[model samples]
Target: MDARRDAAEDGRETIGISWSSPTRPARRDRRQRPCAVDPVMEIEIVHLDRRHAGLRIADPARLAHLVGSLARHGQQSPVLLVKVEDRTVLVDGYLRVTALTDLGRDLVDAVVLDHVDEVGALLLRHRLQARRSTALEDGWLLIELLEVHHRTQADLATVLQKSTSWVSRRLALARALPALVQEAVRVGSMPPHAAMKFLVPLARANAADCEAVVVALGHQRVTTREIERLYLAWRRGDPEQRARIISNPRLFLKVEAELEVPPVAPDETSALVDDLEGVAGLCRRARKRLRTGVLERASASERAPVAAAWRETREALRTLAARMDAEEFDGRPRDTHRDPAAGQRRPQPSPDREDVEGVTEHRQEDPRGANTRGPTLRSGIEAPAPSDADP
Candidate 1:
């Protein structure tokens, strides 16, 4: 349908949208003008008042796509306008106005909401594009309304259909952000979410370092994951490492990526043997530690997760033992001396074996009331017979 068409014959109403709370204020409280049906109108680009233009952080890629789309398909949506004094203020569609200007067009299709103010329009998000605002964007708006525009938190909470706690958190986030980081976010040089998650805490910790990092990332196309990795490393790094990261974060990310790419193994057998040996080494170390009663000194809460992990590992070892003894794995002839069912290995007979012909006498007893096995007790892992995977 044409934007300029008469809506009386069709019985069309207003924008036809509502928000979180369906029960709105009395019509006197709202700027809801009577819809004499409705007609979308065209406004000149020069007449737009962009006072709230910087409220949204413009994304470069999104703006470029919008420019291309406007060129190929003309304007499919209208920019929203609110009247202020003698000037017509743009309440929404900053990107559209920008895109049209980039295309060298002077006129833009727009809708004028009668008697609506900037605050009302922002609260309603009065536009066709249902784009959700990020938390950082919310912080910007909340700060402006409270400190500069003189709006109270309670009043905003009522209008936004949110609690006062939510408003306070947004204000805190905005307060902690450094000025330079804010500029980076506004111009699309830095991702808003990355700033919110990683940079905010960083600024609180060391504002100078955060500023340096933001400057380092100004023109780079680094992702949120990469930023997170950088932030984590910076937290764990020493002063010198942190300085190097601040100087060239992109290079650090590249180096980290290279380190994760493993060297090609000679063969699958070699890789398998390496993994088995690693597991065996860990188990032997664990047994040595357990003999020292490491678990005996810890509280139950601290030991719960460790106990659960140990139970899972023990069950896996049992399954491995059963599979090792199966004929399909060991092949036809079974080895005669591989019994670990009694938690002991059978060593081959040698001439160096000690003679035990005449040493027996009265045995000693420990405090736990169990008889000692011998004068000396061995304390080490029993090396199991190698599995068939050794080949």
Candidate 2:
């Protein structure tokens, strides 16, 4: 038997053994025979290499925490790596490697896989183990596996330990959102579901408009409902309306109103009209008083308390306006209109006599309608009838 010691200057050591027999062939012992071992299953120290596909984007705060944990307890989990022709690529455990590197470690423990499929499966396993993967991360991984690797969704689903539907949804979300929107989601500017729900449909319907809206509101953290409404308004509105909605969405959403006018007896028509005019005058007076007494005087320090009071009043009015827009008032569908320039209230178009009579008849039939307020004028006075030859 001959034994040799091979030592590298870097302190790495290797041992080799050989036996020579004369006259008789050496019989190998069954127990000592070399058994095939998967290199992917073995954990060994390796040089950290980052030039590889990974789903996780390193977070500074999380990396800091990992650095601290590693400094105290050392690396509890081995990172996964894939061996290519001449280089090793990272598959998972980016944070661990990053922490270890920051700690001035020369080597990292890794499980190196030979095949790309095994690499993908282990990537997903590590992702699940970390439990920090976002939908966008899943989306990116799904795309890599399906498009780049040419893998089926079923195969990925099995590898990811998720339902086929889950894989499909992630892929669909990735495909539906534009690259800009995806970046916005990735950087925490836009939420994943918001991008998937609002921007995806907008992109499908009109890519230019979707891009425009994203460019406009990408910096703001908009809610899902706000995004939905903004998309709807953009889809249905003209250029000016779209701009208005994007700039002041809450104002646009709150400006909608439905108005219905009921018919009165021909003899009582004049009186009903006069009462509406009176109500309109009262509202105009109240608005004028509020504008002059509170808003105009708001700059004065003496009026600070009054300004605070006005804020409460304004909120209450907004609540009332929203409620009024939603429900009918005075036994009629409430007539509401908003002047785009000033955001002021305007009356809805008056119902025709026939429609008014229909509502009147319904009100008589339903006793509950009697308890509600009578048809209220939304806007004060009617516009003058157009002259027959005006055109």
For candidate 2, what is the TM-score?
0.43
Please provide TM-scores, in order, for all candidate models, with all chains considered together.
0.59, 0.43
lDDT, candidate 2, residue 261? Answer: 43
Q: lDDT by residue for model 1 over 84-167, one digit each (tens)?
A: 789888876788788899999999877787756667766666222345677788888898788777899999988888899989
Worst 10 residues of 1 by lDDT: 3-12
Model 2 agreement with the true structure over 1-391: per-residue lDDT tens digits: 1111111111111111012134454233444222221322324235445644345543455567667766865654345566655666666666666677689886765555444444454444544342455676788877876776788888877866789999888787778777877777755566667777778888887776677667777476767877777777788889788778766555555664222246554767688668656756855675566545444434556455654654564455445435445555579754443212334454334442212211111112246433222222333322111122222
- Pairs that collide in candidate 1 are none
The TM-score between candidate 1 and the true structure equals 0.59
